[model samples]
Target: MERSLLTRTMARVPGPVTVVTTLDADGKPWGFTASSFSSVSLDPPLVSVCLDKGASTHAAFTTARHFLINVLAEEQHTVARRFATSGIDRFAAGDMETCELGLPGLHHTSVRVACSMHSIVDAGDHSILIGRVEEAFTSDRTPLVYYNRSFARPASNPDRAEQDIRASHIADW
Candidate 1:
């Protein structure tokens, strides 16, 4: 029941990192690094992100009713760190532009997904915010991966696909 133990256990889980963004009333940008994101439905192009019950961004999220999911490029590690910390201006001195819907979306991301709130469900200590992707863009560039709590790049060789799978086998929880 210790919180540190819980954190350590969760840290062992390798998950892709994301920065969820929205605009405040004054049209300023806001974002936070999140690893708890997943595709919900393909037919509707839905995705989901979980937010801490007490996250400072929660109120803005509820009011904005719209946001974008920027799948980070590996080069965006600093962006991740910037948004993840508290009491920091996440978009300060940044080059992000407004989306078609006026939501703030980061440029040069692996992908930019503009969405509206589809629904919200309460979990144990978080809320699963489901979003209907109204639009999306995928960069021609490769994706940024995360594993064992670190950022990673593509394996590069498809001929080594078997080797990569085998390597993952040894590290299976």
Candidate 2:
């Protein structure tokens, strides 16, 4: 399997854009923009996010006791780009503030999940950080998405209510 091929293939699959933040040993905030955040379990309320092993904040996140996953709103494409960048103060914009669990949380996000580090699993050149969700916050804002190596906003379906009814019927199974 060619790496570029995999990259291109995965790029077509849209994912939620998030900024995962944690405090380092020095209590300084470190974060990176990620599109690989997901729910892992329901019984214990687990969530997982991926971080590149070579990322500048990898060590801080892998060892941090707690972190926040800020699900960026559709209008926050700039915030995603800022955090994704390296060698600059990502928090200099001051959009993030101390929130749940005393971690830096990005404002106006569609969702925010605060979690305690549960475990870290090594996966090739990346590490999967699993967390036990401590709490979550949400707003009415639409989430930002990443697809084809670019930021996108999910389109609203005009027949959403009908779709939901159909989905509810499937849930009855």
Give the best candidate by TM-score. 2
Indicate the worst ten consecutive residues by lDDT in candidate 1.
93-102
Residue 29 of model 2, lDDT score: 95
Q: Please, what is the whole-model Cα lDDT of each candidate in the order they appear?
A: 0.81, 0.95
lDDT of each residue in 81-161, candidate 2, tens digit only = 999999999999988999899999876899999999999999999999999999999999999999999999888877997
Candidate 1 per-residue C-alpha lDDT over 1-173 given as tens digits, one digit per residue, 9 for 90 to 100: 99989888888776667899988778767788888888999997899988887888887876777889888887888877787899977788565778646777777888888889889888988888899999888887665666667777756787698888999999999
Model 1, position 40, has a per-residue lDDT of 95
Query: Model 2: residues >4 Å from true position, as ranges?
Result: 160-173
lDDT of 1 at 131: 92
- Global lDDT for candidate 2? 0.95
- lDDT top scorer: 2
